[model samples]
Target chain A: MGITKTQIFNEEQNDLAQFFKVLGHPARVAILQYVSNQNACICNDLVEEIGLAQATISQHLKELKSIGLLNGEIEGKKMCYCINVERWETIQNQLNNFFNKTKSNCC
Target chain B: MGITKTQIFNEEQNDLAQFFKVLGHPARVAILQYVSNQNACICNDLVEEIGLAQATISQHLKELKSIGLLNGEIEGKKMCYCINVERWETIQNQLNNFFNKTKSNCC
Candidate 1:
């Protein structure tokens, strides 16, 4: 296999790509949507809500948290999860800017 | 590895998941950004602009086209590409709705 040679890309390109890469998983998307729907911090219910195994959901949660999109607070033996609103708004604006910028350009 | 059994999820869940999955690749993200930046219909410059091999860029283009994010017009041996405005707006609204809905829900 040939090496990707990702070094040729700019940091902004790579950073933006990494952000999208985290969003690429179906399980993660479902988890995010579910969490978004929940609105309040959720604990122990993701497995039931998302229909994935606990391990799978946990892994997805970890990915979301890694991106700072989700936050968790330990309440006893369970961890309550909710969207980090500040990060959510940041991401939304970033995406909106990216998409809106496209509208002005044509070729 | 166990089978994912995606059949268990709702159609809306699956559709939304597929959209994000398509957005997950760095190459695809770069392609979208490049196309957005170009503003004019880009034909053969991608290999130069993004600095990926022809086949690699072609594969990435196919993925974006598959998702209806890009439109291509074949001119002789080359294909000119641009973002499809209507579909772009549709996807933007869908994503906006998904995120906005999350803000309204709790627990």
Candidate 2:
């Protein structure tokens, strides 16, 4: 959507849309799933796991980080990444609220 | 993502991503919320409610319908739309499963 279009909707709508937009890509979704499934922070393995180029994976990681869904730290030479649990739960609740409040009115 | 890139991910990942991609816009989210909030199916009120042009709203509606999130019918000269209850529940559960199964592995 255009920048001016976002002003019409409320904050919650824009926020939720941002989250959804970030996760709209399959690579991003795959990256989140792989990172979440790990027992420790992942570094330098996304390219192999997601079968994408390093640059592509980094771009996807950037998108995920932009939405606060990821936490990253430089461990010596590598940047390790993990899920941001608090943000994850908050997003989960927000989505749940959206689903719960919007009753189905099929005609 | 490119058409060829979608083949790299499994069906579930692709399907879920498609759902998120369709919902990435606030206008579509607002449309779903507005239609779901009503007791009856809505027809021709989206323009005033979402503050977008008729063509834009129609395009968004088309995207939502493509993902099976909405059901539309030609009612006289106007098209009425409502949430697809079964598809909605399925998507909600799919999202819940994705959130639940992907445990937080914050570093």
Candidate 3:
């Protein structure tokens, strides 16, 4: 397929789409859930918690980080990861705005 | 990229991922916004409004329909589409629950 004609859409539309796209994978969703449930940000626990290969989990983690939904820090030999709350709140607001503002139904 | 290990994840994770995946495109976002803003459901107007190719818009509509986010009804010569409120509310709640429930800051 040709590249998405992003210019045709507004900034909010593009931003909302990006927020949704980052959460589009089951592995990523499970990873965020796992990290959020823990009292401390996690490192090596993800591969076991999510039941995915280390490489796969790492790739998912990378995608999550690339989108600013997740943050990672090197802790000696391991990298600890956690949800980036600031970005999460921004995404939540965008999502709520989209869902809550659509009024007067059709069809 | 290998296939996603969907079997490893729970039903809720899969469902949430599906909701986001369907909305991951700017064109679809614009289409939903356009249809919601209109007083009546729409069809061909999307191609012009979204400024995308007919096939691209049709594909986006199909994906939205697949996830129950949109509904289309054939009217005489045109197929009108609109946001599906029931599914929209469900997704909205799911997103809210995910965002609201995550607490306890982590670095």
Candidate number with greatest TM-score? 2
Which candidate leads the pack in DockQ? Answer: 3
Tens-digit lDDT track of model 3 for A1-107? 55777787789888888888888999888888888888876566888878878988888888989889888988888888888899888878888988888734766
In model 1, which regions exceed 4 Å deviation?
A1-5, A105-107, B2-4, B104-107
lDDT of 1 at A45: 87
Instruction: Provide the overall lDDT of each model, using Cα atoms, as 2-decimal numbers.
Output: 0.75, 0.85, 0.82
**lDDT by residue (tens digit), candidate 3, B1-107:** 55777898889899989889888888888877788888867457778777777887788899989998888899888998878898899889997897887633677
Q: TM-score of candidate 2 restricted to chain B? A: 0.90
| Model 3's TM-score against the true structure | 0.93
Candidate 2 — which pairs collide? Answer: none
Which regions of candidate 2 fall more than 4 Å away from where they truly are? Answer: A1-4, B1-4
- Ten-residue region with minimum lDDT total, candidate 1 chain A: A35-44
* lDDT tens digits by residue: candidate 1, A1-107: 65546687777666666667677666776777776666456566879876778988888889889888888889788888887888888888877876787564474
Compute each candidate's TM-score over C-alphas: 0.87, 0.94, 0.93
